[model samples]
Target: MTDFDIPSFLKTLSQRAGVYRMFDADNHLLYVGKARNLKNRVSSYFRARGLNAKTVALVSAIHHIEVTITGSEVEALLLEQTLIKEHRPPFNILLKDDKSYPWLHLSDHEFPLLAYRRGRRGGTGGKFFGPYPNSGAVREALNQLQRLFLLRSCEDSYFQHRSRPCLQYEIRRCSAPCVGLVSREAYQRDIQHTEMFLNGQSQQLITVLQDEMLDASSRLEFERAGELRDRIETLRLVQEKQRVYGTDRNMDIWALVEFQGVTCIHRLVFRDGRLLNSKNYYPDNLAGEEDPLLLLGYISQFYLAGHAAEGLPAEIIADIDSDEMTIVLDALRQQFDRSILHSRGVRGEPRQWRAMAEENARVGAQTRISGHQESLRKLERVSQLLGLDKAPRRIECFDISHAGGEATYASCVVYSEQGIASQRYRRFRIRDVAAGDDYAALEQAVERHLIRMQEASDLPDLLLIDGGQGQVGRIQQVLERLSITTVHLWGISKGETRKTGWEFLWAAGARQPIIPDAHDDGFRLLQLVRDEAHRFAISGHRKERSRSRGQSDLENLKGIGPKRRRALLLHFGSLKNMRGAPREEFAKVPGVSQKLADQIFAQLHGEDRSV
Candidate 1:
């Protein structure tokens, strides 16, 4: 393997465009690359002169090389991604967030449920409105949809058991169907309006609503007319705010910013004239790559990934154009069952979208570089202290949090040289673990995280857990079970005094804790990772706790199902106010019959009296 004949292999390669794979001494895939001319590309690596450091290292490690000829350069580019994904070679620039972004799903139930879904598409048949820029955008969209259409956002179980209209009904954000306050026919109509609004058919909806409003007014139904007028106005305002990016084209704009070999990609999504959402990506190991190749690789992974394939736009605008655009367009058309356009230059909204993406990419690059430089220094010190091969570029830290053994959560926060890799941060809802069992929770989180990494080369170079030796032992057992031995695992724990300055670093097989100086950069870096994991876990736990507490309180009130519970909460704004509200106020709620209101009042008062 050491005496591998590169010259002979280069001589045998054809000039045809294709993909090339480089393997190390043990036949492990070191890199997967593509080129327009297989012979020239392969020979370039074996050139007697003008080789960069990265290429030199790659060439030096190459024990064997393989190539697959393609019909065209575009085919080569497409094949390259397939090989990279299949082999997950260490040298390729990988998409860090392997999972898909969140999408807003409209369920197919009788009363549709609007939900923020991530990962796999639900088996339940319905329409998905987005692969939004981020979860925040999805949430915002869901909120807007609820406000606009007043559709029920509750689960089936809750909807089925509803005794009366919920808070959403009281707040005019839902047409209560739970207790027959709103008929199926009317609720179905609202669902249609919601679909139209989300699908960018707001103009049509406004026209219909306007007609209804006038009809209601002419029929002397002033109250109904006013409601229709308000709905039409809301639709108009939303449409006005979202200025169309393109006159007729739906486009996805991608731009890149590179600093010191690190690259940041900005994606701007515009649909039906409106800028839907924008997001930024930090792909690793992109230094020395040409703009065309880099952009091509990104688009391949971006759209090929399941989450991204949804709601495909008709056109794509990139800051850089390449020979691969035609291939990408072809692939996208086949994937989405519609032709897609690719443009490197454009005017109007597309140009604006690219400008926005470029600006963000530049800012993101600056942030990435500054953070990466600072982190490298810290990582170097950490590597030396921990006696590692080299600096740790990727570090993952885990922490567990619970509210009195309820609503437990485990958070894994990632820290690369580029500071906080928030996109890679994962939060696990601890379902199987017993309440308050931090060890079990940590073990479960570590197990699941490792299992996902089993087939991927993107495993972190270092691992940190927020606890003492016991927690470290639990994680060690998980690694052992998973047969992962290369990852460096350590535990950060508050020392004897339970204070910041006296923190203990417990590593595997270490006889005693290694305490770095308080001011040491490595220790500070560790603190950053540990603190982030703790904060993330605590936040998740708090959210879960709040939801559970809210649901529990409402569920305990006799005859107060999801709908009635919602109505009371909306009208009163809180449990305290709901308990204090006069029984007559409850009766005024849309779905609350006088008898139901009396029962609610009696139940609430009885509990207060008993307490």
Candidate 2:
């Protein structure tokens, strides 16, 4: 066993009974485990049989470890799960699906019925049978519930105010509870039966339905008997579709696959004793590794960062069993304060579930890799068409906008190898330029951007303008005058009919036009960048134009300085209303004295006024 120093910071704790945590150089939690005796369990890592290559590597980078004392093994286990979920250490097997489970919510009323719900509970009362894997499964169960129970599914407000049965009643989907077509006692009986059906008491429900149908038939209630018969048939069909039948336990089966330098984690969720949804996750850049270790890391990180334990299931089944697995289960138990079984199976149904999940993960990783390859190919093609030194890994596009020269603004949008670099995008208001002069606006925008970049030493590799030769020429002249030599600039000219795909590219000092291949990937890439810049510019321009318009309206009012004008506009929501207000309302403006208010009101209304 290789001995390593426990950090001086963590050495003071009582190491009697509890779980300990290990973290790597990046401060990512690598592993978490508990022991009956902390000193013994932790010291085992330094013993002759203590370390493997992976653990040795992990220990070398061990920056820190933390420990907590628990009264019992159960307590330790529980605490372990809680911390694993919270910290999401890198060396535990993680189930990465974070999607909220869909649920079938039954409204509590005279005629309680089913509806699909997500997130926290806010709907009126009834039992919820979920977190189902997806909404489709919830819908399917809901449809069957409606057909079988004949409960009203309308909104409570609408149901209370209704004077007559709606279309659902006509179609026999609802029992017209809103209109008193069904007695409360009968409705309660139906609700009870629906509960039983969802609780995996299908056989009991079938028996009860059969007896009801016989009784209805004997009493010459043929319509009631036919309805009962239809409901029985629906229940029978639903039963046939049930994949797994237990006592209504919800569980999630998780599996991890490491292949071809990628790692994918798959989750199969079971709700109401039936398989409801399957999810696949491909964690980024985890290729070429031992499968078990990768699986362990994924499990720890994923659950810590996911909603799995918060949505606490009865059981969790997985393929790999390691010391880290025990630590994770313990952590989850502690966090939720519930005994959740973590099971491992070498054969049988559990194995099959694990296999399915792993296969799904592999497929998901393959799909992601393929999509990324295509994106890179398209970017490369774009670079070739533009005759760039290399693929424009970092492209900056610009657009200028103004409302007939008011509030002139320009925006720069950035795109990198990973797509839109929104954080790097910037907007500029053309200050030293005359209104409605596109050339001046373009030059001002270019100069502002270049000066900032020069000061900060952060310039883009490529510059794209959203106009033809004129705007492009202006930008080029500005760059030359400023002696900015590092960046390449080009202009995107709109097509002949002002449509896409027919645009031309204009570069500085080039007499020949560069027309990109219409069907080329490079063209598509450039188009996306150009369109995004235009969108951003237009949006900024609209905001500035609105502000200028508001200022103009305020200027029309007499004796309204910046402070008072801003106050009035804020209070009134718009300048027109501020201008139209009575003297009494104007007096309420934060800074307006009574004399000023009266004068302002009279001036706005065209009465004898004073300023």
The residue pairs found clashing in candidate 1 are 150-173, 165-563, 166-563, 166-566, 166-567, 167-566, 167-567, 244-273, 245-273, 372-417
lDDT by residue for model 2 (1-611), tens: 12323322222233334567776556567887767667567766655574889777666767655554433343354445545655666665542233344667777665775778874476546777644434664676677688667877777878889998899888888999888899999988888877777665676666676678779989999898877766665454333321233226677778776533346677767656554445566666435456666666676676666756336677778866746578877887776677767766445446545544554455444333334354466568767787878875678898888878888888888766554566678899888777799888877787888888889988787888888888888888888887888888888888688877788988886776687766565776677678778767876776687686763545655688888876665445455555433234566557898668767765553332210
Top candidate, metric lDDT: 1
* TM-score for each predicted model, relative to the true structure: 0.34, 0.37
lDDT, candidates in the order shown: 0.69, 0.65
Tens digit per residue, CA lDDT, model 1, 30-54: 9877786676888888777999998
lDDT of 2 at 389: 80
For candidate 1, the 10 contiguous residues with the lowest summed lDDT are 237-246
